[model samples]
Target chain A: MGLRRIDVCGLPPPEPLERVVEALTTLESDDALVVVIHREPVLLYSLLARHRFHWETTLRDDGVFEVRIERRP
Target chain B: MTPGPGLSLTQAPPLSVPFRFYLGAPLFALLAALLLVVQGPDALASRWMPEALAVTHLFALGFVTQVMVGSLMQMLPVVAGAPVPRPQLVAALVHVPLALGALLLPTFFLTHWPWTLYAAIGTLGFSLAVFLFAITTSLLRASAGFPTVGGMWLATVSLGFAAGLGLLLAPMHAGLVSVVVGVRHLHPVWGLAGWVGLLVVGVSFQVVPMFQLTPPYPRVVLRFFVPVLFATLIVGSLLDTSPMEPYVWSLLGGEFFAFAALTTYLQQRRRRKTRDPSLGFWRTALLSLAVCSLLGVFRPFVGLGNTARVDTALVILFLMGFAGSLNLGMLLKIVPFLCWFHLQATFLGRGPVPHMGMFLGDRAGRRLLRVHQTALFLLAVSLLWAPAHRLAWSAVAVDAVWLGTLLVLATLRYRRAVRALAAAST
Candidate 1:
């Protein structure tokens, strides 16, 4: 599977959200998108679910959130 | 690999719920400007003048409180993970009485009509009761941790105290009450320091880091500052008749000074290097707060002879310079963000959505900021030279109208985008 990563750390609200949503539009069925962000995007999960995507989030050691998102099988 | 909490985006109320309050706020500001223009220097001559009282309430109740309530309605669910029940209904019940009371109370202040005072008190009392109940319930249920939730709790309790004091004093101010109460001074203290100050501090904890790309507020501040500030206000109010009152004000001043200094330092170290008009507004607000803090701490000791003008200047600096600037700056970010957020949600995966810039450009925001600064400058001048009151009023009128127009234009853009999205879907 292809992996695409985007770092949205230090970016303000809605910009991070916008970048992730934009990346999702181009995401292939076989690919996973890894997003690195400053904080837990609590509002984004519902949007991802609505668009038939499943995401797993982990708090990295460096204090950033790493989210892996892909289409639900 | 854990999923985030199941905080539903659906909890965010409809755009109209907050927009109505946002859009409605500037009209009261315009009314305040008109009152100033008509009364000229007399309106601002003294804190106890009826005209001054009218104008203060116009800004405090009509503009500041209105926007604050709307923001809480939106933020509680989205930021704190607590949903307010029946948001539209609650908004309606709150907004109508609030707007009515804001208008009637100011009119009563100007006219001294006994019935208007009673009616104002009744409507405002009802509105505050509903708001406090709803917000208090939401805060209790909020899953968010300290600084935000805890701060909100203190602020809401403060509002209850402020509103309670105002209701008790309204009749006394109008000569409707026979008993003389010495706690008349506590009302504004609770309203300004307690309700307004605490809420601003609490909201800034989330907003500055999220929007301005600043580091989060210091942990010590997040944990103790709000609670300490609230306690200080309580102590100061209780000791209004005691010699310790001045020391309390000095302590409160020091706390605010610390907050302002920390925020300024954080902004200087902000990760985002891009030019932002909101930063200018915030800087102006912080500077004003610092100045006000110094004045508060020193005035008692130095003994400024003309207390009336100094008090009026302090009021203008706090209400207009600090609170007003912060409100304007936040609206610049929030209105566009909300518009884009809602539109994106509606058009999910349907097509590319318009970015926030399309809704309200940075240029427009900067232009409004310039006008706001000019108005502020004119207000400062008007304090020194009485004739400048006319110019100040004019600038204020333009500032209010310009802000209202920009917000309306942003809404219009949102509507056009919605129409386009619907057409594409069909």
Candidate 2:
């Protein structure tokens, strides 16, 4: 499986949302996108579900949120 | 991984829920400005003047509270993940009476109409009761551990006290209840410092870092500051008739000063390095807050005999300078963002979506900021120079019109974008 990583740690709202949405458009069926962000992207979860993607969010020791996203089987 | 708490994007209220309040707020501001223009210097001459009270409520209830209620409805769901129950119905219940009460209360003040006062009491009482209940329920339900949530809790409590005290005072003024001198002073304190101040602090803790890309406020400050301030307000209110009043004012002033200083420091450290007009508004707001804090701390020692002019100056600085400036700045960011956000949701990748900047450009924001600053400056000058009142009133009127026009234009632009998206989708 291919892997893409995007860091949106400091970008404002909707920008982070926009970038993630854009990345998903180019995401392959077998690819996973990893996003590093400043806060838990609560709003992104519903969008991911709507688009048939599954995500796992982890809070790093450094207080950043990392969301791993992939297409649902 | 633990699931995010207190936030559900799906629960976000319909855009109209907040927009109506936003649109309504500017009209009240315009009305206040017009009243000032009509009443001239006499209206501003004393805080006790009926015209002054009318204008104050127009801004306080009509503009400030109107915007705040709408914002809380929007923010509670998004930030706290606790959506207001039956948002559309609650919003209507809150908004209609609030708008009515805001108008009626001011009318009562201006005309001394018994019916207007009684009607205002009923409407405002009902409106605030509903709002406080709805917001308090949502806050209790929110599972978020964010410091902002705690701030919201305290601020809501403060609103209860402020609204309750205000309701009591209105009846007392009409000889329905015996006047309590301490209650008279406590009402504005609870409203401005407790309700308005705490909410501003809380919202800033989230937005400053989120929007400006600044470092988050120190965790210690975030956790302790709001609650401590709330406690101080309670203590100060109780001690209003005591010799300790000056000390309490000094402490309160210090707290506000620290917040203003901290915010300014964070903004200076913001990573964006871009020319943001919102920054100008924020800076002006912080500066006003800082100045007010200093005045509070030093007034007793400086022996600036509490003249009507001095009292008016402090009120203007707090109301127009600090709260008004901050509100305008936030509106500039929020309106465009909401327009963009809703449009994006509607389009759902079927077509191109307009950027936030397109709805309200930076140039327009900067122009409005300049006019607002001019108005603030003229307002200050008018207090000292009697003849400058005309110029000040004109500036305020222009500022009000400019703000209202900008918001309307932004909404119109949002509609156009929505139409374009629909056409493309079809």
Candidate 3:
């Protein structure tokens, strides 16, 4: 089954930390999901850890990073 | 007031507006509101049971104060033309006692514990310190022209008086004083009308026009509201009711003028073609304010038993209907805008990342507005005949569901926006 698509545009400067965790928890996808983020993924990784969202990040450029997560169905 | 050094508009904005930290407070306040919704009707039905104090404090300190402090922090900058000193520290310091005190105060009141009283004293002192700092900073940076800022000045003064009175009344239940000094009586007035009411009125002056795309309320009305209400509250406290009637009348008249201004503004709104949840909220707030004005006239006739019910209704109308709806409506506009604003700040003119509207789907928000409307409608009905405790609780449950839905939608939109920015960067 294809994963549900969602966007994370226009969040305030504080970044949507509580939100990223919430999305990961609710999405519940076994299929690989692609998440793109601006800037470095360091802050986002820590936030994910704080909220207990296990995932992997791959840096493609200074302003672009990709996160992939797979949920057990 | 002296236009002190560093008087530039860009440098010296009001300190009352702490947009970010204050935003966090509402989440906790909403949790507290949920608890009160579960507990309120049952406690009320029991007819002044000992537990009523606990429930009242839950809403008062937990929900109301939470929102109030956060809002103060956020608005101080906008209203006073100055930012608060060490805002992060202030938030951390206040949050501990405020949250803990709300929980402990009720338990102490019910059990009559001395330690809890000591704890209460500590918390109140901490809050007093915070407010004093906020007030001082606000006065130092305040500029001319904003009536809302003037209202805030009055609110700060009233808070000091209210806090002092509250401290005195703490000894009443312990029989330290001969007569029951009526400090607790002023608690609601200071809290409800003085602080929250004044601030909301002040904000509505700015928000209503901007959001609805209407003209500002008349300058005369704006100038009169603060002075008239402050005089009424002060004179009424010092003198007997006979002399204070005119001031009270003035206060009510001010509120009516505000309501009328809102109605007039709504009539001329550029967005008149829409039936959004925000519009539903506007109607609810206007209607509630009108009812509250009528209640003010009948307040003298209300007996002790009827007074509690009537007062509770008024509180529900003002706090939930007026403050609550305004909060929801503003969030609808703010959250999405913030999301988009942050994402696009760096790329101002370079690329084609959409405006704030592009980040938040207005159509999707419009659909969610229906859910909010439904929840609010059920909430109003539940308040009227809160027959069983569970019924009120269920209303809260529905409201939580609505909140959850909004949270989900906000997150999805936020993620999509980030991805879009990332794609453009690459």
Provide the TM-score of chain A alone for each candidate, in the order shown: 0.95, 0.96, 0.53
Which DockQ value does candidate 3 get? 0.02
Question: What DockQ, between 0 and 1, does each candidate earn?
Answer: 0.50, 0.40, 0.02
How do these models rank on DockQ, best leading? 1, 2, 3
Tens digit per residue, CA lDDT, model 1, B81-109: 88777888889989999999999998998
Comparing 1 and 2 on DockQ, the stronger one: 1
TM-score of each: 0.94, 0.94, 0.69
Candidate 2 lDDT for residue A22: 77
Compose the digit string of candidate 3's lDDT tens values, residues B56-134. 5655565556666766665555445555666666767776777777767677767888788778867866866676676
Interface RMSD, all candidates in order, equals 2.7, 3.7, 18.8
lDDT comparison, 2 vs 3, better candidate:
2
- For model 2 chain B, where is the 10-residue window of minimal lDDT? B2-11
Candidate 2 clashes between residue pairs 3 or more apart in a chain or in different chains: B6-B80, B6-B81, B7-B81
Question: How should the candidates be ordered by TM-score, best one leading?
Answer: 1, 2, 3
lDDT by residue (tens digit), candidate 3, A1-73: 5564344433332344334444554554455555665433333443343333456656664545567654533
Show what share of the native A-B interface contacts model 1 retains. Answer: 0.46
Model 2: per-residue Cα lDDT over B1-426, one tens digit each: 854332344466777888888888888888888888877898888776788878888998988888888888988866887778889999999999999999999999888879999999999999999998899888888868657898898889999999989988998877778889788778878888889899999889988888888988998998899989999998998889898886897788889999999999999999888878988999999999998888877766777875566667767788889999988898887788788777755665667788889988899999999999999999888888978887887888788889889889999999999899899999
How many clashing pairs does model 3 include? 36
